[model samples]
Target chain A: MNFKLWVKPFENLAKKDRFTISILWVAMVLAYWLITTAGEKKFFPTPLQVWQGFAALYSEGLVVHIGSSLWLCLQATVISIVVSLVIAYSYPIPLLRPLSRAMSQLRYLPLTGITFYLTILVTNARTMQVWVLVIFMSLYFITSLLAVIKDIPQEEIDHARSLKCNRWEILWEVIVKGRFDYVIDVLRQNLAITWMMLVTVESILVAAGGLGVLIKNSDKFMNHGRIFALQIVILLVGLSIDYTLNTTRKSLFRYSKFN
Target chain B: MNIQYEEKDIILQVENLSISYGEKVIIRDVNFIERNVVRKEINQGQVVAVLGRSGRGKSTLFRALTGLVKPSSGKVLIPDYSQAPSNGMQPAKEVEEGDVGFVDQKYTLFRHKTIYDSLTFALRKSGEKGSEKKEKVMKYLIEWGLEKVKDQYPNELSGGQRQRVAIIEQLLSSGHYMVLDEPFSGLDIGNIQNARQSFKLIENGHDLNTIIFSTHDIELATELADSIYVMGYPRLDDGSLGTVGTIVRHFDLKALGIAWRTEFTQDHLELVKEIKSAMLAS
Candidate 1:
């Protein structure tokens, strides 16, 4: 094969595609640098200061804080998901309807404002923090899952029943399998809310070694660079989780693309 | 009137079947002495079609037959193969899964499963094992020309493909009989012809698979059904709604020289007209 012939295909990209691929990241970085360094009395930390703060925090073991926060969030998320699934699936029974209704109404109560009540109930600070996060996140979980469960077409259930599936089989084959992708989507969306509530939860329980505690300590000492750096870390972690979830959902439900 | 078939040939019997929702009766005294009592005998290998307009209880009747809906006072009798306790009587009981395969109007295939997996799941449910399960699934896939899309999910297939897969899945799972609710509603002409061919093939190949599908299309029903059951809203003597759907007419097409290949002649058109009138009659 001639060298030019092989190179011609590679050079066939549109000007717009080339600009987007090469220039978008550089432009974003330049914008960030200008915004952080332009002012005389800096409200935001300079990029150099933020980078140094990140290095200092890393040397002092900030990974422990990140790990603890992530572990707590994961635990609360798994518990809330299981409980929400139970509530949503049992919503049809008349006896459970009132309980579900009560929970739905409770979602309107502000999560952070209820910290004192949770503290009173569970005096141990760490336990109280976990409880608050679980309760806060589960409200959204229950509501979203209830909507998903309700949106399951009756025909799908009847189809499973017609195939000789008993109640449990219908739950597994129809409800779970049918809503698998949507459930992951719901989790991905609600996980952002959970992370937003994490700082509030961990700040209340100062002894808890998490990013929220680090942010709280930084806030108290007027360490603006450390605050900005920790916030950036949190954002990156959240975005990474979201990207992973999105990729998983796409791969698992490739068939949905054709529809 | 009781239309009796020989006991050995009888595949299903709806005995005095009356179904009601609260006080509003949908099928009142389906096979009793009262008015609107439907007495019919379905034999093995017959393609029966129930024709009716919307809300005429055709689907309700099918639901009752398949044991999805509980009848108010009557029962649907299917041969209880599990209970042959040497009483010299093959007792009949309510329909159960593996007894009657049902396909709804929307061809509800498992979205998560591929065509091959769906068939294998059905076979597995019926206790087929290992190579036998794979062989049966492959056989049907080849037989129906579905081998090409065997690994594709239901959403990846066309509407016609989904319907065929639904029918084939039901056939493999529930071998003896199948009930379909509005199986041909949304299908195009090409798909309808394809469906007809599949049904014909199943009927000819399997000696025991009796297909019962409900539809409002008079022409399609008349063409496919060996016997047609016309359901309509019954009217009392005083010009009031009878609160139930009754069989207005039952046509044994074979007796009238109607076959799968029967051309639409003047007599057939007349019969279609009569069925339409009966379906619409108060």
Candidate 2:
């Protein structure tokens, strides 16, 4: 073993060594939990107990709940992406700049306060849940996208003007088409925010039986083991989504890596 | 052999131009006129170089020339091709954005577009259609030796290929006028040679084609530009250097009997020295 290689800062590890260290690190975490929780504790559940709880939930229609949450999340995310892109891309126009600016700043407003108004306006439970998630994600998405648009170099716009592009064409070509990859990146960032809000939105409308409803039920009955297992599942799904978006960005915008 | 050339009617005119941001003046009192230069036995066009030190508002002057920035005081004029010439003189109008094409030092092509697609996009305003537009862009791609890299993105191209694409993009879009800001600032010998060839490709296309560029290399400026303008801070009444940039010297090489020559002679070196002294003084 090259001991110095492991000790040095910012040093690269061999792939085999990296894999070995990762596995060992996970094992160490598991061993620490087992060692520390010798006696039965109220809040802390053993790893095996959590696994059994997960298996029980899996048998009792957990897959349906996961699918329901995923479907709702997808709907809200799609709406957010489209709406945010429209506002952000139109930000350069003098007439639309103020509107876009106000929309981007909406992230600071309390989601619960907006939810009160949305419940009054939107009568249907499912529609209200979707709107809640959409509002939450769209605000953050607009903020991220506006930053990306703002960072675009002025020379690109000047180059477009030199090519005889009118104001609308400049907005389309330079501001919209030129920054599509950055849009995808911003989507990736804001998708995480959407996922974080998914449970809260789903729990508010329990008529829609979803992962959030399952979590709320487990919490109400003091089923700590089941709650931990469902939390683990939620974390894994979020990670998988993040991975997929990262791969999509890498594959679609191969040139973005150059920047 | 005396290379016979006639200076005809004005092609571009910048009259008493000044640009500023609030209280700070960048370039002031910048005035120059470029006329069509027709040479016998060969096709030639104007390659005017604006030589200046860093931060002397060469970029501001270029922004005005390209109509990207409105001048604070004066106007830039070019022939209004939308109207016909009256009594052997083309109708002149104030320049607007998109009148002159500009390529910066980075050779900034759209990062997402391939060379072929970028050229196609440049022709968006052109009234050509379908296969005709594609053919026109393809002809340029082939002639400039960029056909092989047509499908490749800008990052996939080398420095020379990107430069050609940038120049041709502007050539096809703006037509007749192209401005390059520090085209040769960070180039090596081979790449610089490629840039020189790119200039020829542009000049060979049209007699009215003009390439106005800025560079710090005195020797390269003398080698490329038939006319040179030195921009720097001028002496004030109190003998202090002024902050506002203005053209302090103009070298009309056409009158010096040195332009269009196959070689840079001792006279060119002497001229470079004179330009250097002028730059240092201002």
Q: Assess every candidate by TM-score.
A: 0.81, 0.95
Strongest candidate by TM-score? 2
Candidate 1 structure quality by residue, lDDT tens digits, A50-132: 88889888987799999989988888888888887777767766789777767877899986568767867888887787788
Q: Per-prediction count of colliding residue pairs?
A: 1, 0
- Say what the RMSD of model 1 is: 7.0
lDDT score, residue B202, model 2? 85
Candidate 2 residue-wise lDDT, A132-152, digit = tens:
999999999999988988998
- Which docking class does model 1 fall in? acceptable
> Model 1 interface RMSD, in angstroms?
1.4
Best by DockQ: 2
Residues B1-282, candidate 2, lDDT per residue (tens digit)? 556889998999999999998999999999999999998766788999999788889999999999999999998999998998899899999999888999988888888888999999888888899799999999999998999999998888888788889999999899999999999867788889989999988876778999999998888888888899999999999999999999999999888877777788898999999999999988
lDDT of 1 by residue, B126-241 (tens): 67677999999899899898999999998889888999999888888877678989988899999988888888877776556678899878888888876788777787889876
On the 0 to 100 scale, the lDDT of residue B40 in model 1 is 37
